[model samples]
Target: MLIRYSKILLTAALGALILLVAINNVTDYATNYQFVSHVMSMDQVPTGSPLEWRAVTSVTLHRLFYAFIIAVEFSAAALVLAGAWRLLLRRKAEAARFNAAKDVAIAGLALAVGLYLFGFMAVGGEWFQMWRSLPDAEQAAFRFIGCAALVMLFLGQRDD
Candidate 1:
């Protein structure tokens, strides 16, 4: 039984880590969109050139996609943590409901966001064939959301 909890907790920890990474990217985007876009334009960066990860290059960061990504990531992290908290406390009934709801958000909204970004990366990203190939900040926000989802899933599975 203890081993089971440990396993679940371990899973949660990994998931949280991924989610945190995604969140960090979201922060970077929120904080640096304008700067990045300016840099991109200043550099006269060709669309086919690799994206400068550390360098603010894309003015497009101010787009709706960026905002949507941030919101979805936030939701994933928030709901995942909330559900995990309930489960950790051994509130099985509540945990189940909360976790279920969170799972829906993560799988639905999170999934959509991820897919959209992936496509954007492929399309405007020019198949990542650009010279620098950096994604401005590499989107740590998605990692954070993924991590949070993992943790919540673990909690939901816990026998406690």
Candidate 2:
């Protein structure tokens, strides 16, 4: 029971954190947008590098990318929070039932991991050489990925 409660609380906490992040991204659009824009533009990458061709210089694409990221964040937050609610309601149910309720939370965490790992790290960090110009962005994405992945693993465990 204590373990169940801890799982539920951790899920809720992660959901809240993601929710806050989505809100922050929406409320402070330009700030995050700039980060995306810079990463996509690859202006921070060393000039004349072999991979310079990978830079996306289009502002339209930048906006689109940023919009997509924000949308994913909102969706993940919703799923995670909803899953947490389901877990709370089923906290006292049999282990199988409680475990079944974890599906939604797992989906949310997977989405978050994909976004940070593939979206930021693979596309922006490696493809765009963001590490050269914006190592902090890569680090931030790593942190998010790590947190979400940890919660996912914890939630995947059977209650029994």
Error of 1 at 71 (Å): 0.6
lDDT of 1 by residue, 31-89 (tens): 54553344333344555445534343344544654565556556554554544453355
Q: CA lDDT of each candidate?
A: 0.45, 0.92
Flag clash pairs in model 2: none
Query: Where is model 1 more than 4 Å wrong at Cα?
Result: 7-31, 34-61, 90-160
Candidate 2 lDDT over residue span 1-160, tens digit each: 9989999999999999999999999999999999899889989777878988999989999999999999999999999999999999999999999999999999998998998899999998899888987888899989999999999999999888
lDDT of 2 at 126: 90
> lDDT of candidate 2 vs native?
0.92
- In model 2, which runs have C-alpha deviations exceeding 4 angstroms? none
